[model samples]
Target: MITTPEHDERMAKMTFASVYPHYLTKVEKKGRSKEELHQVIEWLTGFDDKKLQDLINEKATFETFFQQARLHPNANLITGVICGYRIEDIETPLTRQVRYLDKLVDELAKGRKMEKIIRGQ
Candidate 1:
């Protein structure tokens, strides 16, 4: 499916905080812990507990959230189909980053080991 620029725009404008709870519920319902979820996010975005909370409290948009992120060096290693799009094939940087995060969380929820999710530390 071609992602129209408007679609990307809406996705970019999505609030990270608004979507966080859903992600948390998905993982937790699958027997994962919040720490594990946070670990996955931190690995992708480099935001520790406080920073993450601050962003959440501020209801940061995906654009603002990523703008503040110092992405992991191995973030490119995160590649797969997620949300119906191939992660590596995504042309928009923000969209790719979002899918990288989604793919990581999906892996965690599926019980993949943390070492593998973070690309072996």
Candidate 2:
């Protein structure tokens, strides 16, 4: 088990851009389109393609990435277990946000329809 400060420190140093390609690869390998991935991200963060690209180019850390993000009102609708931690049970704000993205991607890779993943069915 990790402590909050430890998790926060790690997230603060982790760059979203460095791992974003892996997310793209994961979904693409599952036959999901990159457009779909972008759509979900936009829905969650309120950052359209251009803004997202700008953030990626800036090499934003997970904290910085979410700090600038206007999280969707329905984001609370996204709930489930990811990597052994229940999304709602996550104690750290930044870590919860990261896991939210992870859970969404996991849903996509599982072949769930976009509507359900985005709207939380």
Candidate 3:
């Protein structure tokens, strides 16, 4: 994934809060609960419910969000394509990290089990 400067900059500036509702809707429509969504988030980013809500309330950008995250050691276990880009092939660290979250959310929206979505972590 060769991200253009504009793309990366835009993504870096985009708030996690902006995307949060969409993710919530995606999973909720698939019959998943908010707690389950938060569970995956906690597994990947080490943000507990309180911290996650704080970030959302502060309107943190993607860059800020990841910077604050204590990313899971098992994060690399999250693989496959998301938004047409293969996770392993992405060279941009931030983009890959974002896609890792995307892939997890995608799996959740697709009705994948919690254990499987978080790679059994």
Candidate 4:
């Protein structure tokens, strides 16, 4: 549904902003007020001020979280799950046979029939 390049760019910016608050602070620290800092933190974390403070107090690091995000299987599972198909349900013997037949047909159409090519017949 994300149709426009501009929308994708905005999403990328939001993702970067959410992932790196220090980067934003460095860019606008001088003119930014205390309320703006709170707003930025809230926007980044999708949490209220108290929750954000707790997260900070717990010694969370963006680098650590980002590394864990890369390893998370939720996204992988979601792709398969939402697609109305299971990966394991694929790759059956019947599917393999059909693929083999398709390859043979393609070879014959291209005048590279497998038996002649393979046996030098």
Candidate 5:
């Protein structure tokens, strides 16, 4: 895993004019949009203008942007496709809520299993 400091440093050195084409290439590969890219930045940095400017100005690395994007609420669908799982169309608010809730439950179950193993139970 790349450390956050290294990630930030690389991001700081990027120039968008040079990186935009590559960024668009990744977006095409992922079947996402420029809007999604902006949304990911907004989500990751709490919509900080300075941070957004830095990301845009530096031609941020796709790896860093992709990692940040995955933290967005819609990222589960992207991950599903990447992992060879079927992506569900969670268009409705209810469906979205349930999906997130299910993810939360799964995480809790994994935490419980980890705790048991750590405790030698």
Candidate 6:
């Protein structure tokens, strides 16, 4: 089981740009388009395509990346187990937000419908 500190350190060291290609690869491997991935991310994080690109270009860390995000009102609707920890149970707000994005991407990669993933129902 991953401890909070371990999760925090890992997230702190991760750059959104560095992880972007991997997200694309995960979704694309399942025949999902990058546009679709972006759409889900945009719906959840409130970052449009150009702004997301700018953030990616800046090589923002997961902490900085999420700090800039204007999370959707429906974001709290996203709650479930992701990587063993319940998304709603993560104690650190920043860490929880990071895991929320990770969980959303994982759901998308697992072939979940976009609307449900975004709406969380």
For each candidate in turn, the TM-score is 0.96, 0.92, 0.97, 0.29, 0.30, 0.89
**Which residue pairs of candidate 6 clash?**
none
The sequence of per-residue lDDT tens digits that candidate 5 reaches over residues 1-121 is 1224653455444444465455455655655655544443444324355665666676665344343433444334321221122225444332232233233233233333423212221
The superposed Cα distance between candidate 6 and the true structure at residue 52, in angstroms, equals 1.0
Collision count of model 5: 3
lDDT of 3 by residue, 1-121 (tens): 6878888888889999999999999999999999999999999999999999999999999999999999999899888988888998888889888989999999999999888988868
**Whole-model alpha-carbon lDDT for candidate 4:** 0.34
lDDT of 1 by residue, 29-121 (tens): 999999999999998899999999999999999999999999999999998799889888988899888889999989999999989999977
For each predicted model, how many residue pairs clash, with residues at least 3 apart or on different chains? Answer: 0, 0, 0, 0, 3, 0
How well is each residue in 1-121 modelled by candidate 2, as lDDT tens digits?
2437876689767999998998899999999989989988888899999998998999999899999999888888889888887888777878888888988888898899998998852
Off by over 4 Å in 5: 1-12, 48-121
Whole-model lDDT for model 3 versus the true structure?
0.92
Q: In candidate 3, which residue pairs clash?
A: none
1 or 5: which has the higher TM-score?
Answer: 1
**Model 5 weakest lDDT span, ten residues long:** 78-87
- The sequence of per-residue lDDT tens digits that candidate 4 reaches over residues 1-121 is 1124653333323332353354334435444444444443333224466655554565544433232222222212211211233423433422222222223233333444334322231
Off by over 4 Å in 4: 1-29, 63-121
Output the TM-score of candidate 5: 0.30
